[model samples]
Target: MKEIWNLAISPQVLPLTLLLVPVALYWLLNLLGTLDLDFLDVDIDADGPDGGDSSGGHWFHGALRFVNATDVPLMFVLTVLVILLWACTMIGNVWFDASQSGLTGGLIMGVSLVASVVMTRYVVAPLKPFFRMLRADDEKHPPVVGRTGLVRTAWVDERTGQVEIEMQGAPLLLNAKVATGTLSLPKNTEVIVIAHDADTGIYIVRSISDSIPPQSL
Candidate 1:
């Protein structure tokens, strides 16, 4: 334990060790219920430019695309990466007496960073399906399809809207848009979900009356 502690605080790996502290704290906070971390699971734009476009103006977009490839929360990926880096540094320090100062130490640190990024990026892919399942439960499951909900937006058409449905004694709010050829629904109107798009988490809905107009009665 003493040897492990000494290596963790060594300058070669100190930065990753420092980052791990806060991540561990956040995990503890989550367990204590003081922090609800569901927001961290929200999806980002992964379809953005992969390598720059014609103008080379997609640097930020490209960065996001690369980071989002794992489909897991960025915090989770960072936590895994820091742990890996810390372990690598500890092993190197003990077995090889790796440098802890000067140019050699800087090079070691640089390599650790790049290696951690590449390792985490690929390591998290196989685990993405599991993370996505968790995300779905937190944000969009229990099969709200075919259920009735009220339009929460001023108007709901192919381009825009929202709906609120009662589920498990709480409100389940969802993004909603009418199917093609369906008329728009106004606020407070009743609608039923006809389909759900898992990729976008949007529900395709139609006015309740559209299925059974008053004239039919």
Candidate 2:
């Protein structure tokens, strides 16, 4: 046990230890509810082109094509490769010469550092916009049966139309339709959301009484 502890703290294992500290800290902070790292984005393909090509060359193009075909994130692939390389170094250290093991470990550490930086900068940063968009959509579309809105556009008998409804401190553009057997509501007509149609993913609406104001009526 002492030997293992000493080895864990040794210079040879320093890089791995450093890399693990942040992961451990993130988990600890999450458990305490003091910090949430779930939203912290990390990407492994940051150095690639805007379109995700590694370089404007055949080799990069081919590599990206293969990565895309596998339907896996580039960071995940890089992570597995780093793990395998490190494992090889460990095994080589145990079964082969000491000098060879140290060299292999150093090489693996260098590669892992570079990959980590590139991914953090490129892949993770670019995904923030997409995450924000998803969050916005979720907030805009809540499952409420009794809400009110005005038809923002005309609805045809067989077509979808948009409505503007306010909910949760914001106005959302949503798909809406007139109640079954009712006539199409014109734009700017006040409507009550009667029910949500799951099949068509729209809300059924009816003309509200003229006495009610659009906002609070």
Candidate 3:
């Protein structure tokens, strides 16, 4: 235990070890109800390209693609990556006895960091289906019926999608579905927040056209 403790705080492994501290803190605060994940959400501009600061939006968009963060919780992906990184760095340091921070230590840390990203992808892949089942509830969402929002997913249909609504406060990203008999709404397609399904907490939306009109809850 003492040896492992010394290794964890060693120069090469220490950076990732320190990162795990905040990850633990975030989860602790969440469990205690002092904070929640949304407070830490990096709002991905999902409403196609014209949504927000183009550069910042593209950067996060790129990152999500790089990490394959879709259909799964973001922090879960981050947590897995952080833990994997720490393990890889620690193992590399221990195997090479490179804990004293030299060329070998730096190389171990760098290689581990790159390898961890690849490792994290495969590590999280099998867990995607499980995490997809754990959708966040929308009980606290304000009434958004009759409001308008932009489709934020590649497209929205009966089974899956998201939309960004510009309501009173900051824009709210709501899980959305298109009306039956309606074609899929593509990303950035303006649609009316027609109805809210209280039972399932999904919003039913329809494309803004001459045919369909605003709806109530």
Provide the clash count, candidate 2. 5
Instruction: Give the candidates in order of lDDT, highest first.
Output: 3, 1, 2
For model 1 the local lDDT of residue 74 reads: 70
Across 116-204, the per-residue lDDT of candidate 1 in tens digits comes to 76777777777777765665677744888889989865556684466887788787777678998777776688988899887755689
Question: What's the TM-score of each model vs. the native?
Answer: 0.55, 0.33, 0.62
Q: How big is the RMSD of model 3? A: 6.8
- Higher-lDDT candidate of 1 and 2: 1
Question: By TM-score, highest first, what's the ranking?
Answer: 3, 1, 2
Error of 3 at 150 (Å): 2.7
Query: Over the full model, what C-alpha lDDT does candidate 2 score relative to the true structure?
Result: 0.52
Q: For residues 1-217, what per-residue lDDT tens digits would candidate 2 score against the true structure? A: 6854544455666556455566566557767998754331222121234333233433442454343311233444444444444444344344443443567656655665555444444444444455445434554456656778877653312234557777787776665666567776666777777777654455777777743677864
Residue pairs in collision within model 1 = none
User: How many clashes show up per model?
Assistant: 0, 5, 0
Clashing pairs in 2: 43-119, 43-124, 44-119, 46-122, 213-217
Model 3 Cα displacement at 6 (Å)? Answer: 1.7
